[model samples]
Target: MKTLMYVFIVALGTLACQQEKKIGYVDNGTVINQYQEKRDVEDKFQAREEAFTKRADSISKAFQLEVQQTQIDARKASQKKAQELMQGLQQKQQMLQQQMQFEQQQLSQAFQTEIDSLIIKVKTFVRNYGKDNGYTYILGTSDAAASVLYGTDENNLTQIILDALNAAYQKQ
Candidate 1:
């Protein structure tokens, strides 16, 4: 029984010393940059931003013209009526300005949320890819040159990860 116990302990020790060899690494920056979905989202956001800017500019010009017209009418009225009209116009301008500011804030929040969500999606894809491929460990490298020094191109796996991520995104 003692001899059997010694054999079992030796076997265990041997197994422990043998590490899993199927480790892979990927450049996350390269994957994200090359991902078509990420590029599409960025382009869409840029277009939306440009549209918002144009709308804001158009509204500002229209509001300025209206305010100028109101001022002219206020100058022509009786003194007391002129003062009241000017005050009312000022209040309306303040309200419109406040509304515009609120809309801009909402837009900013929405854009930030969208970007955060996309990053989460990319992270999820990386996690799932690692799990599905039976990798013992997957390291993320931001520097391609450094990665090449440590990992072979066969183990880079960025293209595979990007492809899997896009496929998963499309399915979603």
Candidate 2:
């Protein structure tokens, strides 16, 4: 009985001596959505997307007009000449579509690349923030996969970290 009691006391003392873990959680969606740099990146891409749409629309309209005129010309020509004109028009349309698709791919790729880098940067920022502020762990929570299901408001660092991220971005 004495040995058991002594062992229990020793275990209690050892547990009491261990430091409490400092943990916090941030909502991944909140931080990323509210990040000013990410917003700016999105806005920049939006403008580019608009411009590309306008250019594509203008090109398509011009081509359509050309096609209409060719149809009118073909109506007054020999059947063989009309077929030839249609074949040429079909070729031009296919080439134009290919070119537009390529441009769209390029634009999409560039936007994705920038967004990807920004996410990495945010992750790095959180890691550095954790290290500098003495966090044992800073877990992330998202609707799709919540690493942290429930954290107290006092332990929620979403806004705190977002503010810091924006402040740093503003400085830049």
Q: Per-candidate RMSD vs. true structure?
A: 3.7, 2.7
**What is the C-alpha lDDT profile of model 1 across 1-172, one tens digit per residue?**
9999999999999999896767888887888887777888778878888898899899889988987887898888899998888888789878978987898888788878877787788877777777888877777788655544587788888888888877866786
lDDT of 2: 0.97
Q: What is the Cα-based lDDT of residue 63 in candidate 1?
A: 80
Task: State the weakest 10-residue window (summed lDDT) of model 2.
Answer: 16-25
Give a tens-digit lDDT track for model 2, residues 80-149: 9999999999999999999999999999999999999999999999999999999999999999998897
- TM-score for every candidate vs. truth? 0.75, 0.91
Task: State the C-alpha lDDT per candidate.
Answer: 0.82, 0.97
Using lDDT, give the best candidate's number: 2
- The Cα RMSD in angstroms, rounded to one decimal, for candidate 2 relative to the true structure is 2.7
Error of 2 at 41 (Å): 0.6
